[model samples]
Target: MHDSHNSTAARLFETEGTGNPLDVLKRVYGYSAFRGKQQDVVEHVVAGGDAVVLFPTGAGKSLCFQVPALCRNGVGIVVSPLIALMRDQVEALKQLGVRAAALNSSLTRDEAIAVRHSLAAGALDLLYVTPERAVTDAFADMVADTDIALFAIDEAHCVSQWGHDFRPEYRGLGCLASRFPGVPRIALTATADPHTRDDIIKRLGLDRARVFTTSFDRPNIAYEIVERDQPRQQLLRFLSRFKDASGIVYCLSRAKVDDTAEWLNTQGIRALPYHAGMDRALRDAHQDAFLKEERLCLVATVAFGMGIDKPDVRYVAHLDLPGSVEAYYQETGRAGRDGLPSEVWMAYGMADVIQRRRMIDEGGSPEEIKRIERGKLNTLLAICETAGCRRQAILAHFGEAHPGRCGHCDTCLKPVETWDGTEAAIKALAAVYRTGERFGAGHVIDVLMGTINEKTERFGHVDMPVFGAGKDLPPRTWQSVFRQLLAAGLIKVDHSAFGALQLEPEARSVFRRERQVLFRKDRPSSGKAARGTKSATARERSDLAGSDLELFEKLRSQRLAIARDMDVPPYVVFPDTTLIALAKQRPRGFEDLLDVPGIGESKREKYGEAFLAVIDAFEEGGG
Candidate 1:
């Protein structure tokens, strides 16, 4: 570690204050051009201006601050949210020959002292610390004595109370503006609704900073949702499509995460469980395994995936509904970070809606905050129920306008069937009303289906006129009706009354026949047909076939070997996208390999000979 740090310091000394972002980008990171608002943000920060970047995941947000930090006079201070995230980025930077270090609790005393000595001596390019550590008086005093380049706040949305992953410590970051008046500050995040965005700006004192917001659409990801029928079986079918690929399966509870992981293992899948309740050492071990292993699934609750930097996650599956569109977007954004074709799949049902609502209502939050949270949940429900493109709905939630028919989501690939269910909705509401609106969906559904169960008999609901009204329809169909009604705001789950179905004011118009209700027709629960006929993995590498595919796999094997030798994630060496480029181009020399997108001077000098040897051997054996 000391030798590598000294080498990194020497490299920094050679290139310090180059003052050209593009030069730094090519010579250090190996990308030719700047992506979507990156150039604007980089140039602004390099010119000593503050910025707030709101780009989606995989949009290259790090380069915005990183390039400027290299082109500036002093070391960049990055405020990160998680230790794992900081460590991953620091390791990747080191691989790029950049002098980077992290100050977090994970470091040993000796290691922390080494980092501090490097920072004091101006031998570091970037330093990552958590918000809790950054706000300390001792750390601030230490920074006061160092030559500070800029302050970059990653995951800036955590500063907002309205944000899905808010942390109170982030609020203290507002002091950086006053404490270091001239040092440029940049706040970056991938997910923030309009309300949260405003809150972040106000809280961070970045009102005067230029804001760069790119489209919220992740076009490479295919979104698919289905009704939760035999959820474990449905998940199995989904997993069958993505065989041996890396992904995440999010459950709503710790017990569910453990049970689902155990079940998946029994079904012959490599699975692990992660949650806050697990022992700390075991949790870290599981997380480390997920990061290092190539084809394993980490089944976890929302406690996972906040700051995960693994770029090759092929999919993100939700066994239950997420709390809000923000939460859903952030979690699903963890996939396809390489800009390759990936998938986001979810299975939801009426029970999920009830559970989510109950959790929100039973929590200790202010009334206003609770109201905002409910609204956010409703927006997510709208996305699940929408017959239009799911991407369009998601973008609209972020106040971005995207034309419908993205052609990547489930609705565009295979349009959902819809039916005019005004009559069914009225009957369902009538059942709720006739049952005194104090009974849960099960009792109300039983009354509607004309099922003479003990609860129905005990409540004397069999004598009601609404009883047997929906006898012709299957129980599942009625459940769809009730679920859609709740989603449509015609009815809601009254958690205080033990998940009773209560009609909203809008239900009156539907009962009066003044407004019609349309429900998305529930498809058969055959997970094989859940997504379209095409498999995502096949589509991901459609350009490569036969020998090219073989070469790609060989390159992956080589990358895994090198990564294992270095004790780093495979992507820290080279992302799959770079390997794909290498396979297609088949560069035979170091000069030609440098033409690859992700090959920089450092990587070309380090791994060039090994990769070329593989290519040479492959060509020698071929026609």
Candidate 2:
């Protein structure tokens, strides 16, 4: 490509004509209709307007901007923070018969040159780049003169400095508004509270854009919170239900992630560890395998997942408490993005609560920021302790209303029993206060139970008036009371005392007996994994039956082989959803296979025959 090629490419988007988004949706992406507010956002952008979209994780936010880019001319530049996701996104789009490419550190010199040539020649329909690279002068200089159909900033919540996953590079996106004046831009995020939403708009310079907030609910994702009791064993039990499916297990620290992944590997599971502490190349390799391999589990820290668009991630388990409800929602939201049945299993415990509280309180952030973080943590804690529907609590936190109790969460699956914890709470609060609030939950618990150990005697807490008062109750029961009290805002961690238990003003009510306290005993629990039942409409698949499951495994192997040959993720060739559909229907021939979801004209023509051959052999008793 020469210098003149830039101007020639610029003219590509200046065409006076455009196409219908709905037509592009069917002919290109293989989808029949837009879901939720996608149509509105797409139509708005197609008409040369700007917008901000807040669709849930699995709600198909990419379509809102991707379709408009195709309807018009020129390349669509998608700005995202997750470099790992760029490969998967570009590969998936390429399978859709679209000319998509990515320019990032992952590419070799030759591959980068090829992508640059395609972009300069106006051959690429979509170009994905991270914000750090997107704002660079070299990239901006190259594309400055070229015509851009649109800019889609994925996970736009990163613009919020207070967001759970803040990337400083995301702040540079405001330059897009100034740099690409007339080009339509859509800032999209899956998790953003009202304040964060407004901050994204202002920070991204999208004040003039239309705002579309879809419902923040993933009905197909069952929410299950298990109290941490033998976490590794509990995780084993959770994985048993989702055998041979891809999923992610999130940990709080790098050490834990390393240990857990190694432990899982020893248990006869092919697990990988990804964290910031690992070698960069090794981390990228692990992430790549997770996207490309079937039934691979990635045990990672929050650093691992942000924009992973893998459709068949059937479950996400958390071994530790998340910093905020927003973090938990966004992380768990990674699963079941394809609208298939999925589950989010978390093993929470008193340690998690205490650790999270201490982290928030003693964090290096300013007091004001810490205060807000504490509030978010409490919201998440409430969900873990709620006897009511978990979905309702999550949605309510997002300013959405769901009156009916959702039957998906653990509380809804097995109704929790609430006890009158007022007396227990009062005793616990008194114990914390009598101990001078200089210790953490563990020590306070020991004092309250009259377990006169070295710590109790060393701290001179044995003679405290509230010492033996709660001895009638078991230590486990008292531990639950302390957790509930902490979650209820009646007690907080004292950063000054190095995470000592401290009473809040709300605790005064317990002494006066002015307020009632109710606590739901959170015990170890698990969820029923939606074994993928086949149906045409949902286009869904998961945990299939006897024969169908065997056939699905064969199809997956075939897909994996094809993906390896193509140098793309297995999902790029065919998502598990589509594979399961093929197995259940046992498509007779090429034409019959086209009826499956994600099987479009381009994909059908490119990969259909080989798949149909396998199906034909399986059906004809050629086993």
Candidate 3:
């Protein structure tokens, strides 16, 4: 072991002529193809260029940097945020015979010392550390003095101010490039919108860097949001269809996570609660159990599972709507990573909207808060009540264009019937005006139904002309009417006091019947069909032939086992998409493997042995 005080001057030498970077692919990670823009990304980094890579979850973003790190001279430094994920990745990399180590809080003093020695002695190919630790003076000097090949920022979105997991320490990473001008930098994130993209580029000081963006659409995962009426019961019904399937249920609070997990367990589902409030050992145990075990549902807050590489997850259910659309998109993208059919089910209510708005308002400049609140409400409303394909709506909000219906979401699968809610909306408007628009939905509903409640009688709303005009409509129907009215811009909800309904100027025109307001009549109410149905979009894409299916599943099982032995999640070993490509291509040899997508050298060498063994076994056994 080299002394910690030893200078790393000689470690700065690049691994020149490390063979065709592609040869490294077959030797290290047994991959045959490069997924998406991974090839260009790997080439750019191998040439010592700066880059920003935006690929979706399970898109093999890691290989873009990991492969080049091996081809470039000296050691690669991967700055990741998740401590657990970093440890798992480093351990897996080491197993591939690549000298890899991680520096984090989990490491003992001896372990940290060993890692430093490995760096000084030029014994490491890759070193993973959190941004907090990486930017420290000690770590930064060590990296600056080494022959650094690539500086990879995993979960790069956290470096941006607009991202959900913004960390102030990440801003200091600009110094990495400044301190080591010759070394290449690569920032990779699973999710980032245009604004957040700008923030990342600016914060990382990568203004001149090449940018590679993969498509954000995960066509295999159908997104849907159902209004929260009888939420827990709705959740139970949703879970029934995917019994024994790997899933995640996200709640806003730890107490709620515990309660929901317990409730699900009572219903005979294998469920567990995970949150920051739990003991450290319990959290680690639960995380390990969820990864290693099957049919286990982890009910958690946003705190859990941020850089988790679980690929075979079939579903992600949101018990309450998240704070922003970006959040929703990223969470749901977790499913169907294997390019298999998956569902993104969520339940939303008025309270969820209000709570989200309150969260956005809690801290920030007035302008920033206002901007965030409006964005949140728009996203929430668009998801909850939009009649068109939910996928298109979400994509449109992100400034992406979709030509037609996705035909995969609940709305597209069972199209909603529209009725000219003009009359009903007019009545809803009159009730709000007659009751002074100060009440919430329940109070407004009461007046519309002509219920002689004490509050209604106190305000003389029961005797108003519009009081009983809507009494014939069902409670749910009226609720839909109000929601549509809000959607149509005829009513506004005050954010200050639990979203009390306020009549907008346009409500007068809608009420006068001067302009016809169209709302869906006979809105689709929650039921067995609504809660449980495979997305038509997914079914259409599940077109792989019988042989392909067999190979894919077999490869997946093999990958999962290897991941378990390596202690990383299955997806990190090989994403489902990669497996699908592998099954389709059936590469005959190492050279043929390079032509397959997402198969870079490091990955090929690290994972190649086990995967090739399985494939060879399958082929010989009449696979």
Q: What C-alpha lDDT do the candidate models reach, one value each? A: 0.89, 0.82, 0.76
Runs of candidate 3 with Cα error greater than 4 angstroms are 1-19, 362-367, 487-490, 504-516, 521-526, 530-623
Global Cα lDDT for candidate 3: 0.76
The per-prediction CA RMSD against the true structure, in angstroms, equals 2.9, 5.5, 6.0
Choose the strongest candidate by lDDT: 1
Candidate 2 segments exceeding 4 Å error: 1-17, 108-110, 524-554, 583-595, 619-623
> Across residues 1-623, which tens digit of lDDT does each residue of candidate 1 receive?
01121122236347567669888888788889898889999999999999999999999999999999999999999999999889889999998888999999999999999999999998999999999988888898988888889999999999998998889999999999998999999999999999999998999999999999999899999899888888888888777777757999999999999999999999999999999999999998999889888889999998888868899899999999999999999999999998988998999988889889988999998888888888888889989988889999999999999989988888888899999998988899899888888988888888988999888899898998999999888999988888888778888888888888888899899889999788888887655554554555667788998888889889989999999998888888899889889889998766787689999878876677778888888888991
Candidate 3 residue 246 C-alpha distance from true site, Å: 1.0
Backbone clashes under 3 angstroms, per model:
0, 2, 29
Give the winner by TM-score: 1
Local accuracy of candidate 2 as per-residue lDDT tens digits, 1-623: 11111111122223422768877777666667777778989889999899999989988888888889888778899997776678778878877877789998878999999999888888888999989988888988989767799999998998997787777889988998777789999999999998899899899999899999988989988888877777888788777766657899999999999999999999988899999999989998998898878788999999888888888888899999999999999999999887888888888887787778778776778888888898999889888888788999999988999974788887887788899988888888888888888998888888877888998998788888888888888887887787778778899877668779889998887889999999987553343332332221223343577778778878988998999998788878887778878888887656665567677667777777678777767766754
Compute the lDDT for candidate 2. 0.82
Residue pairs in clash, model 2: 532-542, 532-543
Q: Which ten residues in a row have the lowest lDDT in candidate 2?
A: 1-10
Clashes of 3: 29
TM per prediction: 0.96, 0.91, 0.85
Q: Which has the better TM-score: candidate 2, or candidate 3?
A: 2
Per-residue lDDT of candidate 3, residues 369-413 (tens digit):
467556656665766677778888777666678864888787887
lDDT, candidate 1, at 369:
84
